[model samples]
Target: MSGHGEAQPMKSRKSGPLRGVAEVPGDKSISHRSLIFGAMAVGETRITGLLEGQDVLDTAKAMRAFGATVTRLGEGAWTVNGVGVGGFREPEDVIDCGNSGTGVRLIMGTMATAPITATFTGDASLRKRPMGRVTDPLALFGARAYGRQGGRLPMTVVGAANPVPVRYALPVASAQVKSAVLLAGLNAPGETVVIEKEPTRDHSERMLLGFGARLSVEKTGEGHVITLTGQPELRPQTVAVPRDPSSAAFPVCAALIVEGSDITVPGVSQNLTRNGLYLTLVEMGAEIDFLNPREEGGEPVADLRVRFSGEMKGIEVPPERAPSMIDEYPVLSVVAAFATGKTVMRGVKELRVKESDRIDAMARGLEACGVRIEEDEDTLIVHGMGPGGVPGGATCATHIDHRIAMSFLVCGLAAKAEIAVDDGSPIQTSFPVFLPLMNGLGASLTAG
Candidate 1:
């Protein structure tokens, strides 16, 4: 979370080829769902390979506040002894989720129908995020939310004493919002249904089924309709989380740009909903080999052998594919800067509401680094400069966004000069060991 410590300004410079294996941390999405669903189950749910990042850790803390027994046994091993459905206790103090939007939103939903009142707050970045998107849909289940103007954090949610099931459609394509509604429906009577025009990550749906909930998805003329039978006996699970593709993107993309670099990233999730960046890279003629494709934890997994590509040309990223790769766009733009043609990304207005306005942040940061860029409300076009073409002498403002900070650091690895970020501390929210992990792989990074 921002301001928890001093601002960590960091810088990176051109380096030699990055080698060796990069075993990135576990999936953040799955890590959050595992703890939430584990808290809703009736018995002890043991989890391995949980991402220990601050964001997921915040979720674990919230689960404990809601009367669940969350214990960390080892490096990434944890056990959550749930309180069962409708069994959450009113927390004695305010629930501070740090900088995690996922933690607060999903926890709100989990406690919404349990006759508990929880006050939620976060850091500077998290406080600015709009919570109404989640609180609005939660109201349909007979829950009441009172927050600051625009439905921000420092909010209180009063759980329904006599909750009822709801049938609602999403106003936007957000996995957080979708998962929040599904979690809220866990304690309501009868069936709670949610319809979405575009499918986001389905970790919550898959984990719900794994926890023995009656859930189904149907394709109709309107969209994808998801129905969940409320008040089921959630069973405990032994979950083994897959490696995060989003974290893998950093090392994988860094290898593609740095000359003569070849690296292996093991156990990355190849879930179709999260592989748009890899698909786009393949279209750009990247030399990536997906080796040993298999399934782990109900999701596809792969070991990627990434090699530097001397010949790469940017292509138009499909607008329909935005939901799958929303988090990867900032880094994808860095890759585009090293390509030979223009990379056009449309249907990305959602970037405006992230930790920062990512589109504007990335555009401004890249331009300062001597890369030409253009943007509108819903589109970002990067005019590529080919390999080693960017001058890269400016300091990019991270705006307390992890991806933006990491993206510019990646940009510096292949640029002519050095690149700097105003704040690198936010990277801990998702990838806590980013600097050490990259530095271990031969990156020239320093505390600025």
Candidate 2:
């Protein structure tokens, strides 16, 4: 994906009313899971509304490498013919997940108990992320791994010849880590038990049930206990992926900050575990209408009507809410920059290990744009100067992370001067249509 040229720095300026309908791409999490679970099932799985981003596409290619038949039928429509449980063939080529930690980690777990070996690699940003969180739990199912000294990638995974299930209590609240262990449990001998003190996204658990696997969750005094029966015949499914709330955050935050703007984002996921940013926006005095709330393919969906407001005031985001909005803190910080007071976000040490240390990336970039920010290992505090008060003349280095690149671009759309990102090329890894969508909504974005 780094093939996207970096010579083209992206710039954005103060915008007019951002009016348009934005249909962001499919959920990256669901897109990767649908293809992965499909590849492990017994029959053909047809998927619609798939995110065609490089991250998910790299996952699709990995499925093919494991001897599954994957094909693209049309835009957002894909076919996956699975190899069934415990039937994976050893891949001849290495799997390059291309900047997707989710894709590489989850795929490693999917093949962990299948008596096969595969090596995984990714782009520069992803290579620096810690894979030990995933590889640690996977080893419990008898899988073995050898990578860089710090457990970084260009790694080799050897699947278990005979896996025995074990009960695990999550050390960190990460959907990727939780899902990796569960996927590895697929071919283990007995029931696999996972206990989480705090809840993360449950797409893997929900999809397992939908695909005819025996799974159950019970909330007890300790935590949420998830039990999965291993070695079941995984049935294929017709998956209709929901639009991503993460991608929708860009437009929704943009409309809130730009003066006199009113915009609607259609068919976005409203799952409680993923809507923390929207809820925080409402608390900050945003007038967003969740029109026509309904369910699509077993997930909550809604049309978001966002209107620009200059009266927004920042509020403290509690530690308990961090897991739900972890991926959103970068852009949420941008929204806070345009609000009227201080926005405090804590319990996000997890942000330190993302594609980049997001707190460091945003704090430095925001300071460069003449906005005040405070940060530590677990908290990010943005001191807002109100809408149109920010003097945005600085150019930000994206650190090759998509969220960092997009957050600064949104900052430029309301600041007194233009904001520039050193490289917008990484934006394609998630929301490929970001620029066109922003431009369509009346934002001033120039590609150099």
Candidate 3:
């Protein structure tokens, strides 16, 4: 099983103006997919700039457990020698995916039609997250899943001996669920179609095509129609991942509120599906420039130049945009605390099921920091005090969620007093270099 280990509590103090360029790790979404898709290809797939966080590394281990030969050539460089479709071998022991929902969920789909029975478990966080979302779609492919109450983790997936392709419409806007179904369809017969009323991240669709799978996506009145032909011979190719825009939210928001701060984030993924946070920030009066727009790995990539801007006014985030920036609301809430008026975010009930109840988590932490916040089942309203109006000096519990931890640390960058997170260890799961990267940019941080 994956280890949670001891909690490491850390504190952050109010910092001076932050300046410098930040190069965050590769996109976590793309990293997990790269390892999984690479493991599913016929020949060796070499990858550069893969995120080496625990979540992604666990995916790499899970790929190996399923019989792929994955090797780390050096830092951020790995190679996967795949065993194509329907070629996975059932593991002798349980597969522990640690804190990665993406790792375990996608891996479950990978094995759902391989005539294998694989038991999947994760850390406390992942085990608590509902697995029914992914399993329900896999069931259409003749996969059976038996797990704890409420279809949570410590679950076992019994693959279909004679799998058939399925056409599933996504019930929710979840990239994980969408990706899981597409992966299970790989070994199923015939074409698998998935229609999502709301578009989620298209990494799976993009990566599948890049790996030599025959797939097509079209937008109709209903939503996005994605069709994939199963059992194709996937060929390996080199992959270069772009920097994660999600992780860049921290520094970008910190610079926006720190007064006179300016920062640069280079080579970030500008894929429309994943750039919602940047769009939301811009809506909140952020001055961010998309520099040197170019294409890398078939996805749009750009450099972001952001500067301190205190004239930001709160704006209601259109609910439809939530799917694109779902992972960024926590930090976006921090930015809202510095803006004028209320920032209303709707269509975000998805925040409730993340690593933690993020809406509740951020609401409590922000209120403790003397910021006014109103939250219900599906919306979070953060009343901004504008710059220099936030009161700090609260010890916030991160709920073992990486976003909550990082969001609060960014809060301290502009708060009047020091802010502390109960544990900083969770940051390792996604952005292991977060601390040094922030400090190098002139933000003062001290470990506890």
Residue 261 error, candidate 1, Å:
0.6
- What lDDT would candidate 1 get against the real structure? 0.92
Candidate lDDT scores, in order, read: 0.92, 0.92, 0.92
Per-residue lDDT, model 1, residue 259, is 91
- The ten-residue window of minimal lDDT in model 2 covers 1-10
Per-residue alpha-carbon lDDT of candidate 1 for residues 229-264, written as tens digits (9 for 90 to 100): 999999999999998999999999999999989899
Q: Lowest summed lDDT over 10 consecutive residues: which window, candidate 1?
A: 1-10
Query: In candidate 2, how many Å is residue 313 off?
Result: 0.6
lDDT of 3 by residue, 4-32 (tens): 77888878888888999999999999999
Cα lDDT of candidate 3 equals 0.92
10 residues in a row with least lDDT, candidate 3: 1-10
- TM-score of every model versus the real structure: 0.98, 0.99, 0.99
TM-score of 2: 0.99
lDDT of 1 at 233: 95
